[model samples]
Target: MTRLSSPAHLRQVRTGNMHAVLVAMLDGPASRAELAQRTGLTKATVASLVEPLLGQRILAEGAVVNAGRGRPSRPLRFAATGPVAIGAEINVRHLGVTVQRLDASTEFERRIEVDNCRATAADIVTRLADLIRTAIAACGRDPLGIGLAVPGIVQDGAVVHTPNVPSLNGIHLGDQLAAELGRPGTTVAVDNEANLAALAHVWPHRLAGDDFVYVSGDVGIGAGIVIGGAMFRGRSGFAGELGHVIIERTGHPCPCGSRGCVEQYAGLDAIFQAAGKRDLAALLLALDHGDPRALAAVETASAALGAALAALINICDIETVVLGGSYAALFDHIAPGVHTELDTGVLAATRRPIHLTTSAFGRAAVTRGAAALITRRHCLEPNLLLPPGRRQ
Candidate 1:
């Protein structure tokens, strides 16, 4: 062991070593020797670091593996039951909660439809807190932390602006949710839903590669930009406001006080109005029946969405785009129009391929991404798994 005179320095080294071990295990189960080789630490050090994690129920020993020549070793894996993370989302049409283990396996999940647009911020927070509590109870464990997804601009745990859900503007949602949950010092991270959704694609695995954009469609439209396998929140943390980008100077009015924004044409509300459908289910049904109105509505929305995406791609120089939320549901109906616009509007389309796809999670992507935020933090800073008094 390297000796350090300062206690803080020793703690920092230990935390770093522990983080290395945890991150190595993220690939799968590994023995002490494997961890040592992967993290470039001595086997003795790996054993010492992993002991506390096993004692704390963060890691468990799996079946013994034969090394061919040496003694069989027991592989260690993330425990299936301990130190779960909570993910919650507050959207215009619904509230969702997801509890996931360190391995990214969902343990408990729930989603409920509600007219959040008609509710006050406080009321919505109360409802979201209830869902979180229920999830915690269902999981039967205290969450290591909570991650919240909201459809708006977030800066330093506060919502700076949310045009569709106006009540949340200027609210420090993370702090309020932590207080409401009666866990004052617990970590409650708040971020734009689209950003989180984009993260969900990257953390466990890079579903969209290192450079890509995730565009979310709902009652509001937004984009989550990823570069170098990390989220690209601009200088002010309000970078991916794809909905506000102007498409038609004199087009339909938008809630963000803009005219001809892509959201005005491509958002679910606009599609419903154009298709004469009451809700997504109805619109999906209309599309299934090959109704001309529904097809036309989707075609128009897709063209506008593609145009906005073209501008985003041109500026960011990203080659991949993943359609999420309602867009994922309507991919078959709307993809051709988006593809046509991309081919025409994207300057590099002829030289480099532009890949467009749908999110596997659909609308649940936001909540899943929120959960990943917590787990990723824990993996990077394993000291967070310790009791407050012991974490230095």
Candidate 2:
């Protein structure tokens, strides 16, 4: 790529190039020559970028290999102990916290099942704060930043309101957590649960597609959308409200002051009630036994889920849809019916078949997403995580 005339533009291009090089390294260890080929940068530019990284001990050289025809080269890999990030989440049925390294690997994670919706925000924050401390210590190093994912609409690190879980409404969770944790450097972030789910889909899971929708199913249904390798947060950052999408006009009433919404038909309660079972384990075992009642209930839930997803797919035109949370666990029992509806329901099914799959991260998706959100910057631009003097 050619540089612009202005120095500001030149710096921007170099930053972009630097980020590209770091992303290439994320795949695995490689020599400078290999990094040049992967990032499409000249050897000289790659060397210049590597200088600052090497000085900062962000990238370390491995044992030299003599297999090459021209010359021996030492493979360079991300330094494991330089810095890390802590990620945590609060959902209807659980709370979790985790620590992740700059190389996109989990250092440690802890999860607890609790009725967060019924608990007070202060109490939940206390427990989450404790977990965050535990996770930080578990990492065996200090964290550079921290992030959080919550089940409500978050704007500027505060919870506007949560319909399904009212206790979290009007909670400035981000500000409170930041004050509680007292970490500096402006890396803390607060976002919706499903958006974090989408972020997790990209990293740890490595789902193959730049654009896709992740549907979360626990106490309610949530959708996280990715567009152009980043989240599509709409004009007000309130996009991807998949749970409230209307499916039946005169059906059941929803907490959102809407009738016959997707959650009413596809949420955990709907499936459990349809199967005449209250617990998830019992329902899964019954389905494993090929029980007719369990199969029918799953079909009922899948049909509604597919119907809602058909609308999402038509509007978004994304071919990939991942079922996370409880939906992912039961995707096998529900995939067939969901596919049947998609085959007949979508406007362009023949052109692009909808690929339905389960969340590889499962229940732990949000926590990992929290960490990925912070460390992802380091993946793209290592300078983002380094101190000013150490950065290129």
| Model 1 ranges with Cα > 4 A deviation | 1-8, 388-392
**Per-candidate local distance difference test:** 0.91, 0.82
List the lowest-lDDT window of 10 residues for candidate 1.
383-392
Q: Which residue pairs in model 1 clash with each other?
A: none
lDDT of 2 at 296: 87
Give the local distance difference test score of model 2: 0.82
Scored by Cα lDDT, where does model 1 land?
0.91
Query: Could you tell me the lDDT of residue 32 within candidate 2?
Result: 95
- Model 2, span 335-371: residue lDDT tens: 8988998889999899889888888888778878888
Which candidate has the highest lDDT of all?
1
